[model samples]
Target: MPDLAYYASLPRTRGAAAALLLDDLGRVLLVKPTYKEGWFLPGGVIEAGESPLAACVRECEEELGLVPRLDGLVCVDWGPPRDGVDAVNVFVFAGSLTAAEIAAIRLPPDELSDHVLVAPEKVPELAPPHVSRRMEPSLRGLVEHRAVYLEDGREPGYGSAPLASAPRPGGPG
Candidate 1:
């Protein structure tokens, strides 16, 4: 028989997806929301039955008016429940944008108010503390060419180790 207590201890989390789009100059794109105070990455809570990758794709189109080809998963962070919301698994995918693509971005007035491309180092000043912390690993993942797993925007073991090896050509045997 299954242990009810053990099952109860398991985490029940919601899923959210975002895309990290970088311009040709290596700057990241941040979107200003009409309903939110700070800038954020282009994405939203994942709808039921939708894959995170698909949700990321849909969000980019809905929020930014551009269809960016998401390359790979960049960062996955487990965030604690906050503000009446349940604990959430945030998946951030990496994508690239040319200067022309960025210039053509048209914000959806109902959701986003504006968009800007800024240097990665300036993320702290432009976004919320939690968001900036989450972005750090994603940016590092972009440079390192690997995805990173995080808990509350920080790596496990205080950055001492990686949860998974970078994708290799051959299967793990």
Candidate 2:
């Protein structure tokens, strides 16, 4: 039984997935997932009819019972989709949570086991390899910038509607 990280390491098809680097104080959030047991940020595939931002918020609510305020594009990774097979498109968001927000925090336990807040610099110690590979840059960039979009070649310009749509593996527009 290969784990999600193993799948991420192997060769395979490309797809869209999202991740969240949630911050509370000076610590980032991590989860002990059901699929593989190591820690990764909260996020999942962008379901049909679902927008990227919605997916991020929903993933948090579904897994952690907290609806994170969408902080916009932090860093986008291009890779295979899923665990134990290949890498996936990991959309990491540097988001915020209020004290009132914590009051609403709930854990479903089905998707995630328990959540922990780790020091920004100590994230790699708590994060999975694939996740940490992408997380380290975004987490560090956030301290200096309000946001960071880690796409190879892309540009963010005005779009039509407010609905959050997933950009091509290239990155946020």
Clashes of each: 0, 9
Residue pairs in candidate 1 whose N, alpha carbon or C atoms collide under 3 angstroms: none
Worst 10 residues of 2 by lDDT: 149-158
Deviation from native of the Cα of residue 124 in model 2, angstroms: 1.4
> In model 2, which runs have C-alpha deviations exceeding 4 angstroms?
1-24, 80-87, 144-173
lDDT of 2 by residue, 1-173 (tens): 75989867976434344545454575676778776758877777777677667778778878767667766667776654344755555566677766676556676766677777777667678776656666656765566664454432132344775436736577867
After superposing candidate 1 on the true structure, give the runs of residues whose Cα lies further than 4 Å from its correct spot.
Answer: 1-12, 158-173
Q: Report the C-alpha displacement of residue 41, candidate 2, in angstroms.
A: 0.9
Please report how far candidate 2 places residue 44 from its true position, in Å: 1.1
Give a tens-digit lDDT track for model 1, residues 1-173.
99999988996669999999988788889999999799999999999889999999999999888889778998998988878878899999999998778878888998888888899899999898778998879988987989898988887773434435544468663
